[model samples]
Target: MSQSIFILLILIPLTFTQSVRGKDCVCDLKNSDPAFPEKKLKNVETSALQCTRTITSEKMTDLDRLMLGLQQRVKQVEENVIVLEKEDDRNLYGAVSLRIIELEIAEIQDLLNKLNRTTQNYHHLSVQPAAQLEVMKDKMAELEKFDNMQVIKTNRENERVKRDLEQCKEELNATTAAPPTVLPARCGLGRVVSVAGPRTYSLTVFTSYTYGAWGRDAQPAPGDENKYWLVVLSTSNVYGNFIRQYGTLSTLLLGIGPKDTYISSTNPTTNTIQGPNMVMYGNALYYNCYNTYSVCQFNMTTRAVSTVALPKDTGYSNKFPFAHLAATYAYTDMDFATDESGVYVIYATTSNFGNVIISKVETSNPPVLNQTWSTSLHKRTATNTFMVCGVLYATRYLDQETEEIFYSYDTKTKEERFDLKINIKKMQTNIQFLNYDPRDHLLYVYSDAYILTYELIFQ
Candidate 1:
């Protein structure tokens, strides 16, 4: 009976264990059981691990794309840096080349100044320096042939230098010493001793015209003394046919009371004005004729056009004109001026080697050339020329706002003076036209687009 009880206890224990296992199995099968929840959590963990792996792969792909883009950008930046470096090198080379050219020009100019000084000192020496001068000129010619433009520029400079050398040679070879200095014969209003105030300043009626001529009538009629005349070169700042007349100085200053007089009613014809340099005298407007080397006089009362052909080979159409280092006045080859004596035309001729040639014009039926005078002054070197008291005064550019009357040629005695230092203040850089009104002793200047008048001081 004890053995039987032991067997029952063992079996009961085994059956109890089996019952717990059965309950476990049943809980696992039921979805709402806690054991089932644990098993479901394990499956969810496995799924989450798989999803994380997939997301990691996608992040790696995006990282690879970003890395590739960064590499391309770095390459582009390197290329740009290389291009900039090459450009900088080229710029440096160009700057160095320009500097070298400038230095060469300066050296040539210095050599020219030295040559001028040597010629000036030859007066005290007994030996003729002709051979030395020739050698220097040869050197200058070689230097001038650097370029075509340089050749043109240096040719003008060399002309002046050659003239100076010729003068020196003449002085050296003279059998007799230079004559004693004789005081210049004083004519009407003596020499221009000084320049005074810019008494009147008037921007003209046409402000857009940058080049023009303006003044009162040098030889006025009875009732036209107070009338002021202006001619604006409207076409290319070079050609026009209209003359604008203002009644008085007040009217001119106010840009009011204008009367337009057309030389020709049609398009620019032979009688039309050609250049900026023009003047009014005795009810007639004198100007350069269109497309010709002649001076045209348009009579207001008669409405008649009279032209006188200039000397043959007279510089026209910008072959020669008033020039400075900066610019040249185009088509101003013929400049008309009126002095105490009479009317005159100042021009340059190739026959005269581009020297200033003055001719007296008689205001008869057909204005005829009366007397011609040649001066040693080079035409292109002077910026503008005007007559005062029968003396031709030439001005040169001193600065942007100053013009120096550095030269004079008296027609009475044929005397030339180069020591004049009278300076006139300027409103602008360029003076396109200049005229002296003998009636009022005033200088009428057309500069840029302004009409400026200055009172002259006589000694």
Candidate 2:
């Protein structure tokens, strides 16, 4: 009877507690509501708006802006090319055209770099919420396609411009005839003489000048070597002197005298600043400037001078105005020479396996580098170089009286001959510069302070 009473007491309290809890839960539920679905909807709408704004801002700030700039640059290049094609003077044309092409190339490279960055940005943004970024991805894909097409177009145009430059060079080269395979036997140094006058200016560093017939067979009356055409550098300007040859029978007179001197109105000051290496072809005087790494030309008729820079890293040592006997063999870096074909610049290059680089100067007024050849032999291996036809003959001195013409490079055939052992007999002296006069069939060599001419008597 006691166990039944205990069980009744437990059942009555459990029932009463259950009824009170139900009433409390209903009262709490009616007091407030969480509204989770409404909060979620508001957050999603805000995210979508943010994504749309970002897409619009990025489109304007990134790929679209770069593409617009690229288009403008390409258009400018095309217009410049058209203007260049119409230019009559080769000097101005080549300079302007090459500059335009270079600018275009740089622009294309910049655009490519920007595109690469844009591609990376696109990938970064791709991992964002798919629903919000889907449109952005599509837009980016289209921009990428457009940019690729433009890049390809610019590259093709760049190639076309390069081809045009080559065409211009070919046209210039065609203006002159090819040189002979073998030169005459009496085509070397000859007589030496001196000038008679009062020295007002110094020829100490007067390195650049032309010593050749102005026109075809333009020689002074047989023995009238006293009065001749002269273009030499002075302290003030590059003066043209028509003076008399004087001094004793043993020593040859050189340098410009005080009489009959006139400054080259166009190129006078340009060449005077630095000692240049010069050559004469027909009516034009070609030279390589020391201060500037450019080959310059002076038109004898119009008195106009133009210049074009040499290829980079060609080891052009513009030191000491006069020749240095001590460093003559060591720093024998650059020399300007002319053959029957045209003018050429010979120098040792640190690049291209330390090769001797020979570049042909086209007939353009500024002189363009038409064809180039790299010799396996080092340039300093020889004391001097003279181009015969298109072949380069390197001379190495054995002693005061002996020089071995042991190296020959044929630019046309691309052949190197090391077995050639032609011996040249001369006094032991540093030969500063040498030129083969096609008109008189003699080699003019300048050594020490004397100008000597020799006859090239080949066996």
Candidate 3:
């Protein structure tokens, strides 16, 4: 009786121990804890079935190869079906029953049908888990790249803020030590105003042009600094009709009342104001000349013009004037821009080096290049560019209903941010021209036949 009790105790504990070890094995895998001791056991198909979701590039490649092999097999089966269709019971199976031959052919046909169906489904299966994950991985990699760029950009901005704070302190000290003087609005900086206008003013001087510039002239009359001037870049009108009037600098005043007319007295030719891009500063209008690295400055005061030659090896030296719309993507090799910091000519270098180069205008008979900032971002990536507070903002198409502020380069910080991603509600047509006025902090955009204005609130 004691021996029997002893055997029962041993057997019961042994069974219980096996049960506990089995539970431990399940717990280890379910928790995914590698620190747990590995249980030596078999028949774990349930866990294997549950862990079938892993997908990698190598696995996807193997899947693609398998799909290709299956396609080849399908093709082979199709060829066999053709061969079977030609086979005659009398010749191939002389002693075989006709019903047996038909059964064999039907079996082959059924197998071929199944293979074809499987072939059709192969793409759907491959795309769902593997191809979808591949695309997701690519997007994640791009996001990581942007994150690294953001870190660098943030560090640069911090240093710039520090410098600006010190400069502000110095300015405050100087102001405290000196006499105070107040400046009037006329002496202050000029900016674009948010004027809601679907109002169409006829182009009396130059009827139409695909690519041209129009902006508020620099104090046209003594107190009329807000008056705008229209300059046509091409003779080709909106309908593709060539007009001779656009051969000259078609400068017109834009406003109501008496000053709203063409300024024909200072008409210019190809020697000046022929560039596709133009910006007005003070009493002069600057242009990047067509098919040349020359910048023309047309003076509204004296009706005189001066041409400034860019470097001979400038990448955009002999390029044709930019078209408002292109077959594929919009390209702007030279864009004359102005902000509170004054006027600047933005262009790409000869070698390009995958960047746009900005040259500041200095006071000279023919304006001299003061300073240059080479943005590390490519020029072809943007549709239009504008400057505000010495920072260059570039736009990209985001769809018919939206446009995105995709890229920016701060001259002060020397930092480039390629993923600003600020969405601006805009029409989808090509944005031919973009100009920012600093006085009122408004962005003037020209797309198709519409002139749109948006208020830019700076923080």
Candidate 4:
């Protein structure tokens, strides 16, 4: 009886509260009446706004307005089917949105499950590999121990063996590096005959001026060149060293030096030249007795000189003007042209292309010509440089096309190489003279005071 009374007391209050919810109090009822009080309507308005905020859809604000309007319209009993139709779409959209949320949750749960499974599989792999790794580590340690033992055994003997090998290597090196027992004066290459002078030869200087009675004195002063001596060697080398010593100036070639300038090395009183350009045949010196036109054997090792005929005035005007200790000049023939031996003297001609005619030198014959060669070159001004055979020659031709610094007349091959372009541009002047030495491959070019050397690029 007491338990029944306790149950009745609890049911009586709960049943009374349920009855009050079905009545028209907006806050306490399960649903509100259309004619609810203002205060209750305010509460409903606040709750609706809260619900609107919890919805994430973009149309939630408009949907809340439509829902409010429908409730108000239904309260007024207005004739409107469009508002109901819109309300129906809102309910349908809510259903569709709830389904999308459910799908998203299901997808998230599926990804989480997959991740957990992967983590489990990783743990299982770790458990399976741990023992095998420990076994490998143990084997590796044992192999390392074996290697150490082998190294220790070998190291015990390696030091002594290395020392013995080093000692033997040092002994072998010392024996091989020592000099030989004896050395000879003349080594592997036998008896070298070293000479710096040219082999001796003769020359024929043709002159009409007699020095003893008619012409100028034999020994002339310096800066004077008229009468000169010709020194030719056996190798056909010519040196005019005899010029400054005993030459007569202002008349013929080979001008002599001043009285005190030149002294004879052999005949001091007679004023003979130092012997240069001597020809050595097989190992002996050759000396021709006199400067004559006819070839006559004066010594067993001597070489003779003959007159090559020339065309022009050969006695005075065309002779060598100074003494030189170099190759002797030879005229090719009787005419002012190329001779048989291919020796020639060049002269600039204002009439034709820097005209050049070959004239042979002989003591008896008249000036003759052998061949005529001309190059169309003219110089505008001085200071031009020309290079030939490592020597620089200049141009003195007062014309337009002469800008050469060096020039070469190759007789053996009959070729001429000239620096007409380079010499002109470099010097900014005309070339006057040129000398070339083919053996040394040197070209000495003159540009004002500058001497330039150009190595010939030969084919």
Predicted candidate 4 versus true structure: per-residue lDDT over 202-246, tens digit per residue: 111322211110112112234432332222222222212222223
Q: Report the number of clashing residue pairs per model.
A: 0, 19, 6, 72
The order by descending TM-score is 1, 3, 2, 4
* Least accurate 10 contiguous residues by lDDT in model 2: 193-202
Candidate 3 local lDDT, residue 378? 68
Off by over 4 Å in 4: 1-305, 313-342, 348-354, 358-371, 377-419, 424-434, 444-454
Candidate 1 lDDT by residue in tens digits, 1-459: 345545654422222221246436321111221222345445545655554554443334333433433343344334433433444343644554344335435544554565456545543332233444455456555554433335568788999999999999888878567655543234446678767646556577689988999988888899887688888888888889888888765446545448988888753677898888888888998888898988888998877899899977999889889998888878778888877666889999988999999988888767888888999999999999999877899999989989999999987789999999989989888899998887777788998899887767775
Task: Using lDDT as the measure, name the better of candidate 1 and candidate 2.
Answer: 1
- TM value for model 1: 0.59
Model 3: residues >4 Å from true position, as ranges? 1-208, 218-221, 237-269, 317-331
Per-residue CA lDDT of model 2 for 255-337, tens digit only, reads: 22323322243443454213324566655566555355666665655756677777676565432122222344322355566
CA shift of 259, model 3, Å? 6.6
Off by over 4 Å in 2: 1-269, 273-276, 318-326, 329-332
Per-residue lDDT of 305 in model 4: 28
Among these predictions, the greatest lDDT belongs to 1
After superposing candidate 1, which stretches have Cα over 4 Å from the reference? 1-187
lDDT of 1 at 383: 91
Give the worst 10-residue stretch by lDDT in candidate 3.
239-248
All candidates: TM-score = 0.59, 0.44, 0.49, 0.22
